[model samples]
Target: MLQDHGFDVQMVGSRKAGLMHHEGWPGLRIDEIDKKARFSTPRLLPNVFTINAGSNDCLQSFKLDEAGVRLGNMLEYLWTASPDSTILLSTLIVSADKKTDLNVMRVNDQIRALAKQKAKDHKKLVFVDMNCEAGPDVRCLVDGVHPNDDGYEKMAKLWVNGMLEALRKGFLK
Candidate 1:
């Protein structure tokens, strides 16, 4: 949808499966960024950067502070790598299981606050709340974390709309 709109988009994923799927799409560039690897070069820069991760980080039993620190470092690296990039940071999605809902919510809140703070400091930063528009019936998971195809499509629509809205507001161009 974004490509149809003439935006040069590239997607990077931490997971191998995501990389493989995105690689098959025409005009879609996919890069695999290993969490354990050093952050050196980014495939896309100074245009748009969107992150749809962190569920794994949470599920891996990372403490809140650790997760924040890791995310902060990644953001810093991205910004440092491409200062002019329009950064779109997404809030974490809610888990399907009610047992982990509170944790997910907490992390989402932290991410939102962090994004806000980062935006205040960085002129090009834009925070997008993916969780806000996702209703309870969105069926956002296949297991209890990863979004199903339907959920992903919904997310994509939300993101496109959000980007358009941001563009209209002059938050991004």
Candidate 2:
């Protein structure tokens, strides 16, 4: 999605595409950044970062507060790495059942609250609600976990929209 916008992209994600880069954890996820991995660092700091994670963490049974603290750690790392960069923190998408969906919402709420609180300190943190952007269309999803191409397009549009909003507010300046 970002590449489609003419950005030079270098994406490294878990096999399950969660935020964490840990290797010792047991699960179906593969480590994307084990030792000896090539092209580990970007040539330049990014102007913006749109993060969509926490679904995997939530599904993995991480408590909401624990997820928030871990996510906050990641956010602090990004801010320290690129102090001038704009960070767009997105809410997790919907899951299959109500129980899991509630957890997703709880995690997302924590994410949004964290972003809001951090924005007060670092002016570049912004929240983007992907769940609201995706709406209530089950057909857009593939199975109960992943999204279809159309769903991805929708996500891309929402990201672009959030970027535009940030630019308008001079948050990207």
Candidate 3:
């Protein structure tokens, strides 16, 4: 999607992955400092950083405060690593189960509130509310977790629109 939008995108995604990687096998790959340090201190940093994760942590039944702390740590790491990078926080999508859906909402609310608050301290911090934008459209999601092609297209549109709004608001220069 970013490729089509004429943006040079560098993506890092793992199968069956969450923002918090388990110990033993992979050993905390998602740790904010570990993730940032993996890039080897490149000269050119990313212009934007969009994070749409943490559903797995919710699925693992992590407490709300723990999730919030983990996410907050990540945002702080990103801010310290790349002060000029615009951080875009995306709300988690809908899940299949009602209990999980509620959990998703709780985590997403935590994320949105954190992003808004952090934006005051770090002006580049922004948020894109995927739940509010996409609504309850099952067609936009495959298996109620991940997005399909159509769903991805919708997500791309949402992201583009959000970025455009941010640009207009002078969040991005």
Candidate 4:
């Protein structure tokens, strides 16, 4: 998608999954990424990043109330590590598990508030709401947990809109 948009995209991180490098692994929560991303973030200077986290936290039931603070801390660390980078923060997508999805909604609300508050202090933060009725469901997800190919496609579509929004708002250079 970025290539089609004429933007040269270079995915950077420690792990090599398939053909691209990414900073994430399965079952990672916001706090885990907070520590894990440090290793790659400083070495590879990326211009833009898209973050969709907290699902694992909700699933694992680890520090549920503090997800926002953990996310804010992670964002702060990212900014300090690479001041030139622009971050597009996304809300959690729909979950099939009723209990887990409720937590997803709760964390997503915090994420939304965090984005608004952070935007007042930073111009590079872009808020992208990935939550909606049309999002992934029992059919689209793999075992109703991770996104399947179709779910991934939908995720890319959401991220594309956020990327375009960031570009239009001058958050992406």
Global Cα RMSD, each model: 5.5, 5.9, 5.7, 1.3
TM-score of each: 0.73, 0.73, 0.74, 0.94
Note the Cα lDDT for every prediction shown: 0.60, 0.65, 0.65, 0.85
Residue lDDT tens for model 3, 1-173: 54665655554323224553211122222344335443532333555666676777656555655676777877666666667767677887787767877888888888888888887775686688888756445666677766678777777777887777667667775
Error (Å) of candidate 1 at residue 22 is: 5.6
TM-score of predicted structure 4 = 0.94
lDDT at 96 for candidate 1?
70
lDDT per residue, candidate 1, 7-113, as tens digits?
Answer: 66666533346343131121111122323223433543445666655665555445755555566676777767766656667876777767466666767777887
Give the C-alpha miss distance for residue 118 in model 2, angstroms: 1.7
Best candidate, TM-score-wise?
4
Worst 10 residues of 4 by lDDT: 130-139
Q: What pairs collide in candidate 2?
A: none
